[model samples]
Target: MSKLRVGVIGCGSIAQFRHLPEYAASQEVELVAVCDIVEDRVKEIANKYGAKAFTDYKELISSGEVDAVSVCTPNYLHAPISIEALNNGLHVLCEKPMATSQEEADAMIQAAQKNDKKLMIAHNQRFVRSHQLARQLIESGEIGKIYSFRTAFGHPGPEGWSVDGKDSWFFVKEKAYIGAMGDLGVHKTDLLRYLLGEEIVEVGAFIETTAKEFADVDDTAVCALKTESGIIGTLAASWSYTAKEDNSTIIYGEKAIIRLEDNPAYSLVVQYTNGETVNYELGKIQSNDEGGQQTTHVINHFVSAVVENKEPLITGEEGMKSLAVILAAIKSNETKTIAKVFE
Candidate 1:
């Protein structure tokens, strides 16, 4: 089969570190075009990848130079760009938090269904080797029934990771919508659901802008969540962990306690109630702070889904469900009460 031509929208940090490199590395993909509002950044990326650069996403989408696109833009543009690309009969791999609202997310799903195009969301947490193994263990009843979990994703902040640093769109409400919750929290929400095989049903949260100067959005958020299967847990997302990142999850089960990314060297560790222990060294989990040559398994999965004509592991509907949890948490914070997740 011919290589799948690809265009990437937004030549930002994620595009630079994850999308572009992964797509370029894939034998099934041809990086044909790139779009970003910043001319210099777009030019640099396009030149590096030997692709055309555009300042406008619409032009890139309509140029007919690619078969699929990776939307790495701000949260607000995710839905519109993805819907447009799907309407134009192009498969879309969108960055997370699918959209700022459920309505936008629904519209995106509708567009993909209407156009019969694949719409995959970049919830990279689901692709982590440790996370995949955790799901397997849980499914195989090795952990028995999961009773609770505590998952956190905290870092120094996006300023250090985004192309524009502190002045990036991540700090702006109109562009980003939600801060740490959308940026980091939604990832854990998705992963927990994937690992537990349950949908988050309710949320109680305290989301505040306690840190990060000049940022109008929340810099810290702690959510109390309950899944459909009666599992309860705490989900914390923060940009205030200036000392170091804390991207870890601990699952409490009937038979054992499963720890993920808790220890520096071990990716997963299980402590059984019978005083038995199992350690797994599945390498490090990829992080925005520690930018390295790590395989997220996102770009390759997207490319394969398109090439092999299979549904992506993280589909539009699944993405929307995860987005709903964050949205519900946001509402929980605003109302100072438990919020029910939208179905």
Candidate 2:
């Protein structure tokens, strides 16, 4: 098959460090165009990669210069750009939080289905080796009958990682939609659901803008989630882990307790009910503060799916289900009540 020509919209941090570089590295992909409001950013990236540069995403989409595009724009633009690309007969690997609302997410999914194009969400947590291994152990009854779990994804905040730092769109309410919940929370929400292989049916949460007083969005959020199988868990998303980043999960089961990325020394550790223990060093989990790039596997997976005419692991529907948990948590926070997911 011919190389899949690709364009990337949004020259932000994720685009600069993840999408653009990954596409450039993929032999099966041709990095054909780049779009961002910041003209200089796109020009530099385009020149470096020998791709067309555009300030307007609409122009990039209609330029007939690419077969697919990565929607790495801010949260608000995710659904719109992806829908436009899908409708224009191009595949889309959209960045996470996928959309600010379920209505928009639904539209994106519909557009891809109607156009017969691929729409993959960039939820990279599921691609981590430790996470994949953890899921397998649970499925194989290594950790029999998962009873509960606690997962968290936290860091100092987007200020250090964002291209514009303190004044970046990440801290803007209108552009970002939600802060930590959408930024970090949705990842754990998606990861937990994937590992448990269950749909989160209900949620109640306490979300607050405790840190980053300059920001209007929530900086800390704690959610109580209950799955369809009656398994319950807690999820914490925060931008206030001042000292260090914490991206880990602990699952309790009848047979054993599985720990993922919780220990710096070990990627995954299993403790059995019979006082037996096992440890595995899978690989490193991607980090924003590491000042280095780890192949997220998200780009590779999406590219292969599009090229092979196969369904991706995290499709629009799967993205929506994950986003629903956060959306429900938001609703629950406002109403001070438990919210039923997918209602």
Candidate 3:
């Protein structure tokens, strides 16, 4: 099989750390081109990867050097770039939140449908081994009838992660659209849907920018969410975790309680009401800490889907559903009331 020609559109931390390296490692992919508004960054990545570099994404998309592209730009540029790439006949692996609004998400979905291209969102949390095990246990009825849950994703903020550090686009409201909710909350929203096999139907949120001094976007957010089946939960996303990061989820069910990433020795643990216990020794979830290891399953999945002419697990529609929950949460924060999802 001929290798799929791949292009990366952003030279930021995510692209450098995840997309580009993964693409280079994949024998099924050829790093054919790269684009970024920053000429130096794009040129450096291009030289290292032996691909052409372009300052204009439009030029790269129209250059016909790539069959697929990874949209790793800022949140605001995600929709337009992915849609444009799809319209230009390139399969897209877009970095999440998906879009700033439901309208943009819908447009991206429509573009992919219209062009008959695959559009996958990079929701990497679903690819974690622990998360997969949790989903399997839930589906197998090991955890009977989930009742409530609490999931949180927090860290010491993006300044430590982004390539631009404190001045990163992540803190800019115009570029980021939403802060903690968009950057971290959307991952949980997608993960919850993937793990529970249920859609978030409503949300009530409290959002604030209490920690970061320069950020116009919220540095912390807590959302109360209800699934379609009436399962309620609190999802928290924060950038104020200065001392320690928390990427934990606890699910309460009639049969057992399943905890994920709550312990260092065991990544998943289930304690049953019948006095039985099960411990899963899956490896730790990826963190922003230096030297932390994370599987590149999302990149592999996207490439495999493109090479085999199959749909990705996180399709455009699936991504849009996840985005809807976050959008609802934002609305809930704005109006100080519960907001209906996908309304």
TM-score against truth, every candidate: 0.98, 0.99, 0.98
Q: Candidate 1 residues 14-114, lDDT tens each?
A: 88889999999998899999999989888988899999999999998999888999999999999999999999999999999899999999999999999
Predicted structure 2, TM vs. truth: 0.99
Q: Can you write out model 2's per-residue Cα lDDT over 159-255, one digit (the tens) per residue? A: 9999999998989999999999999999999999899998999999999998899999999999999999999989999999998999999999999
Worst 10 residues of 3 by lDDT: 287-296
Which ranking of candidates, highest lDDT first? Answer: 2, 1, 3
Off by over 4 Å in 1: none
Per-residue CA lDDT of candidate 3, range 1-343, in tens?
A: 7889999999999998889988998889999999999999888989999999999999999998899999999999999999899999999999999899989999999999999999999999898899999999999998999999999999999898889999999999999999999999999999999989999999999999999989999999999999999999999999998988899999999999999999889999999999988899987787777544465688999999988889999999999999999999999999999999988
* Model 2 stretches astray by more than 4 angstroms: none
Rate residue 287 of model 1 by lDDT. 75
lDDT of each: 0.93, 0.94, 0.93
- TM-score leaderboard ranking: 2, 1, 3
